[model samples]
Target: MHGPAESGWLLAALCAGTGAYCLLRMRSGVEEQRRTAGGEALMGFGMAAMAVPAAVFAPPAWAWGGYAALFGAVALRALWAARTGAHHLHHLVGALAMVYMAVVMAGTPAGGHAHGTGIPLLTDGLLLYFAGYVLLAGARLVPVPAVAGASGAKGWGDRPELARACRLSMGIAMVAMLLTM
Candidate 1:
């Protein structure tokens, strides 16, 4: 999103598509998958909205406040969910990161530089987090005996590989978003 218009559009599409897939994945037979997919879908959609090209329609500073508030609640929800599983902790971090990014964007001037306005160390930490997550999630995409792919009558929504790929895509998108910030 920090790059060209083309890149912003691509990122938006990727995030939105992943979000939609995750939404459908909520119907999975596994209750845990359903819960995880629900949170992930929210995150994916939120990222897509944020990743929209500013050149097209820049939100007012106040709108960024709304974003912060929204993600704040999301972060809280993710925190509660983390009690059930360690994976939800990642969602909590992601929601908090969104809130941080929104606050940063609110402070940026109308005509901003390529390198966004924020504490370099903080931004770098976020970049590192997302990058490492991408690597780990990408590795999980490779199917193994323990991490078997969906078989028989399982729907696309229930496929572990596709779910992992969705998370991987979101991770890559997060890295890109953080880079621009």
Candidate 2:
């Protein structure tokens, strides 16, 4: 498998740029934008962390464990907030995925493949999931005809489009990372 050296850096730049844009939105003094921007910022930073080269700053086992725990907590919080919207459910899933990746990496030897055995099921499943997520999310970002008084009439914060873009980016980043595995 090819190393992630190149793709990782590109993903990092994308995530950082998205995070900066979200931060700018957060400063716009809109409550809904602020809330959405907060989640986007977290996702962007988290993905950036995952995209970094291990040689540059490999975290210790404890750090990985901490990451798993932290994301687990975030997942739990998202679950608790599910009544707010479907986005919360997506957040929970994303956070849980992060936890899974962190725990798996923590258990694996340094510079070793977490799925080195070439397990078709796990590898193919991840590939399909991320690929579908990226496609669906990207499609949703496309502007379409909206019914009058529909939810689509709202601003960026009211809609999940920006958040979807962030998720799509993360999905692409994860797919790249998985390919390198």
Candidate 3:
């Protein structure tokens, strides 16, 4: 991400922390929750790496290709997994977004983002998607009568709010990273 070293570091930390939490969530009793957490963990960690300040450590040109390839594979996996549930569709979108950003970065010259795309349609569309996701996810966080959870001792994997918060954080991180692009 092309930005102040301080802000980039902060973003990286935020993402890394989210990744760590997602890893913990993978110990969930529910198979679906564990599966979802694993995907979120990947996204969180990948975002953290990409958010690293260029001023601190700019990756070599080839590294961008590596990022693209890794995310591309992830996108494919998410696509296949999407058949099982709608959450996987969200994962598919997130993975594709990462791939898009990786390709964009690969095209950017080292030391500066001067060659960055000038607000292309892809970027705009992604911004709309993540922004809308953030809004919808944020709204879901507020407990309402219809969507309220049942009262009882909830296991870590069964905690919908935490999972939603995880997604919300990723959505915010995505929006921030997109803005920098």
C-alpha lDDT of all candidate models, in order: 0.86, 0.70, 0.88
Give the TM-scores of the predictions, in the order they appear.
0.91, 0.77, 0.92
Say which candidate scores most in TM-score. Answer: 3
- Tens digits of per-residue lDDT for model 2, 6-70: 66678778878777767766754577568767776776777677767675667677977887888
Looking at model 1, report the run of 10 residues with the lowest lDDT sum: 143-152
Q: Point out where model 2 deviates above 4 Å.
A: 28-30, 117-126, 145-164
Clashing pairs in 3: none
Q: How far is candidate 2 from the true structure (C-alpha RMSD, Å)?
A: 3.9
**Colliding residue pairs in candidate 2:** none
Candidate 3 residues lying further than 4 Å off, grouped into runs, are 145-151
lDDT of 1: 0.86
The order by descending TM-score is 3, 1, 2
**Of candidates 3 and 2, the better by TM-score:** 3
| Residue 1, model 1, lDDT | 36
Q: Per-residue alpha-carbon lDDT of model 3 for 19-128, expressed as tens digits? A: 99899899889888898899899999999999999988999999989988999999999999988889888899999999888888887878676234635788889899
Candidate 1: clashing residue pairs, number: 0
Q: Choose the strongest candidate by lDDT.
A: 3
Model 1 TM-score is: 0.91
Q: Is candidate 1 or candidate 3 better by TM-score?
A: 3
